[model samples]
Target: MRFKSLKGIQDILPPETYIWQHLEHTSRKVFEKYGYKEIRLPIIESSDVFTRSIGETTDIVEKEMYTFPDKGNRSITLRPEGTAPFVRAFVQHHLYNEPSPQKYYYMGPMFRYERPQAYRYRQFYQIGTEALGTEDPKLDIEVISMLANILKKIGLKKFTTEITSIGCKECRPHYKTALKKALKNKLNDFCEDCNRRYEFNPLRLLDCKVPSCVKARTVAPAIIDFLCAQCTHHFETIKHNLELLNISYVVNPNLVRGLDYYTRTAFEVTSEALGSQKAVAAGGRYDRLVKDFGGPPTPGIGFAIGIERIIPLIKKSIVHDVYPDLFICSLGREASDRGFIMTEQLRNRGLWVEMNYDELSLRSQMRKADRIKAKNVIVLGEDELKKGKILIKDMQNKKETEVALETEEILKAVSNKK
Candidate 1:
């Protein structure tokens, strides 16, 4: 029997990894500029952590979570999303006690049992940020601005920012009641998932992708209209700040995120390139999350971008041309041994160098170097080893020169351009 990788998983091989590296590098730079410190969390956590935070009625908790019984018979699950675990970490480590507003950024794989498609996968990666302990609308504006800048930096031209206000604890009940009344009679025409969501989270029905649900909810009540006094002001303030920064956005009535904790301001950076699954990044205010996770009544907001979805968009939009700095070519046994030492020395100087250790022929080594597109080739053969010298060949200009293996000579030879 031939074993194969399970469905909805992908292998990121060589050339494809260049895109991942670029994305990570750009994310770090942008996140750092916003004063977000990096935080790493465990991939697995208590099942209740997600059930309580992401909401038990959500698909992630209901049918998609990868849960199992560990050795102690404790329920553990691979994280399906990024925010809940970070919230757990924030409370467990007492980060909320020391700081008024703690900002953290993270990037890693999240697992969910779902159907795979072009960009959707069961196991995928996300880059996100969390800001804790601030109800100020400015923080919301900052997060949205930072996400927009990141998309611009990555060269996503066909994207737009959609913002909405999902009301706070004060006004959501009224909105929920109105929504249920509107859909109560038409529930039979909705999908089973939408029918279940109606009682648990009517707002989620707006996010349903089913064509029938979309048509049914087309005239459904929007949460923005029911915002309480405070929520309405906060939402208006977020919009004012965004306009102050000249950040363009469209107010989306149905942009309630998938999670239950979100309140007030919600936003998504969507791309036109990916058809129905066009949301490259989405997040919003989760003011009650910290308190729900056992921390103080702190306000927090964040956004998470799907790395898999963003990478393909970047590849289609950005141009990256990276090549090795030098290639070490070994001709014979003795030369191969010395070449290994020389390779280490070059690497120690903060240069990218490559060489085969299995003692392939000089022609084969040169071919490999060419394949990797190394700029310079350093040939070490029996003759050059006997003479205590090496041949430096510039791959671009096809120029060659012999230099002594002395420290100064080797450094100058490698550093000099052809």
Candidate 2:
């Protein structure tokens, strides 16, 4: 029987894996620089974690989450997003007690049961950060700018940053009422999803991309107009500080995050190069979630960058090639055994070393080394082993340097040449 990978799932193979590593390393560097620590969360959690946090009326809980009952007859789910589980950990561990604003970042797979499109998958990876315990708008600006800096360092161009204030508990109800009143008559013209969203989640109706829904919501009231005095000030502060940082952004009135936990400032970074699945990263503030999850009142903001979405764009901007620093070609069994020991020594000494274990002919081994783009090649045989001397060939320079067969001498030759 021939089995294959499940649908909507993908294997991230190399040189692509190299690109993923590059992205991970770059993100870690940037995140650490901004005083955010890494937090590793599980891929599975109690189903309520998402349903309670993402909202029962939202599309994620209504349709996209992967949920099932465990053997204990308790419902379990593959995490559809990162924030809820992070909040659970935060509350359960009382990380809130540590400092005024506790900042953390996470990177892992997120499961969603939607129809996979280009750059969209059932099991996708996300790099996200959450800063808890403050409602300061400066934190919002810093988060958005940090996201821009990561993309900049990763060599991504041709993207736009969009932001909005969805209003807090103090004023969102008024905006929702006005929106429903405006869209009531036109609800029949919207798609079925939009129609359902209208009754249960009017804010999401504005988020619908269906052409008719999009056109209809244009006539609906903008949430910005309904911002209460406090929310208004918060929005203005975010805008003013972002300008000071020179981070360009557009205030998108219709940009309501898909999650229900979000309140106040919301933002998304999108690339036109990714058609339709344009959002590469998005997030917002969730001021009430900690209290809702049975913890003390706390405020939080975060964003998640889709790894699958940014990889193609990053590839266009950067080419990551993996090559062995040294390839040792062995022509005989005795030479092969010795080459194996040499390879380990060089690797232990902090060099990328490879060797042909299969006792292939000299020409075949050389071909293999060349195919892997090894920087240097050493041909070891009975003659060289007996003579106690070998030649290291520089693949790029096409030059050869003679060195004693001792590991220290080979190390010196390679180190000096490099």
Candidate 3:
């Protein structure tokens, strides 16, 4: 049989990876600015980590997760989403014990067994940030503002922010009761999934994207109306703070997060450029996830950017070519050996460099340099090696300079450009 990548998996090869690198770098910079340090977690986790934290009724547990028995007959799963694993790390490592609010960010692939479409893939990447151990509404505003700032920094400004408060333990039950009551009258009109959601998580029905379910919910009672005094005050304060920051948003009563652990705040950023799969990023506050995962009570909020979705929306010319600072083209046996050592020495000096060891003509080597878009080309011919001098050509400006082949002279010459 011919080998191939799995149906829903694709390689991030070549020029495409330039965009990924830019996105990851931008995310790290932004997250670090907010005091969030990077945390690396295993791609596979004990199945219970998700089942216990993500809830048994959610689609991620029932339908999407890639779970299998391990060598020890223990259930292990490829993480379908980031938050559960992030929380697992927090609780397992006792992060909350170190400080009042533990902040972390991650960038990596997540696996699921779902039908892929548009920007959604079975194996996909995400950039997410989590802030644990705080409940101040200003933090919620900060997260939303950060999302807006990140999208703006990435050149995705033509997007809308949708925000909502789904209430908390004290008040959400009442909203669920009201929503279930209103949905019951029109339950038959919704899709099968809606009916299933009705029986278990009634709040989820409001966020359903199904055409029929969405139409049916037009008459359903809104969750905002059912928010108790405290949640109502909280939502109002969030809106007031958003106004203070001049962050435009629409109050989406149906913006309930897909995760079971989320309480109070939930928000999403969408773009019309992405068509029907409009959401490029989404997240919310999960105030009780720490305690649920065996840690002391902590309040947290975060957001995850769907990297695949963001790639398309990113404007062209934003991700530039990955060009090496120098490419060395050498001819003759002695020149090649000397060129190779010089390549290593230049790299040790922290300059991006590339050199060919093959027996290609100078023209062929230049072609390779052009393919990689090298900024500077160094020509080390037999005579130049014998004379302790080399030829340098700037690919961008079409300028040429000759200098002593010593590392310091070459470094000074190349490093002097604006």
lDDT of model number 1: 0.87
TM-score of each: 0.91, 0.95, 0.91
Model 3 scores a TM of 0.91
Roughly what TM-score does model 2 have, to 2 decimal places?
A: 0.95
lDDT of 1 by residue, 58-128 (tens): 77888999999999999999999899999999989999886667899999999999988888999999998
**Cα-based lDDT for every prediction:** 0.87, 0.91, 0.87
The model with the greatest TM-score is 2
Best by lDDT: 2
Greater-lDDT candidate between 1 and 2: 2
In the range 1-418, model 3's lDDT, one tens digit per residue, is 6998897898888678888888888878888788889999889999999998888988889899999999999999999889998988898888888776778899999999989888889999999999878788888898899889888887775889999988889888887787787777888899987787788888777878889888989988777887888788888999999999999999988887767989899999998888878889999999899889888888899889999999987848475745698999999888899889999999999889899978899999999999989999999987897798887899988899989999888988888862
In model 1, what are the clashing residue pairs, if there are any? none
Q: Which 10 residues in a row give candidate 1 its minimum summed lDDT?
A: 409-418
Error of 2 at 212 (Å): 3.3
Backbone clashes in model 3, listed as residue pairs: none
Candidate 2 lDDT, tens digit per residue, 260-364?
Answer: 999999999999999999999999999999999999999999999999999999886667765788999997788888999999999999889999878688999
Mark the regions of model 1 whose C-alpha exceeds 4 Å error after superposition.
Answer: 183-196, 209-215, 317-320, 330-333, 356-362, 382-390
Better of 1 and 2 by TM-score: 2
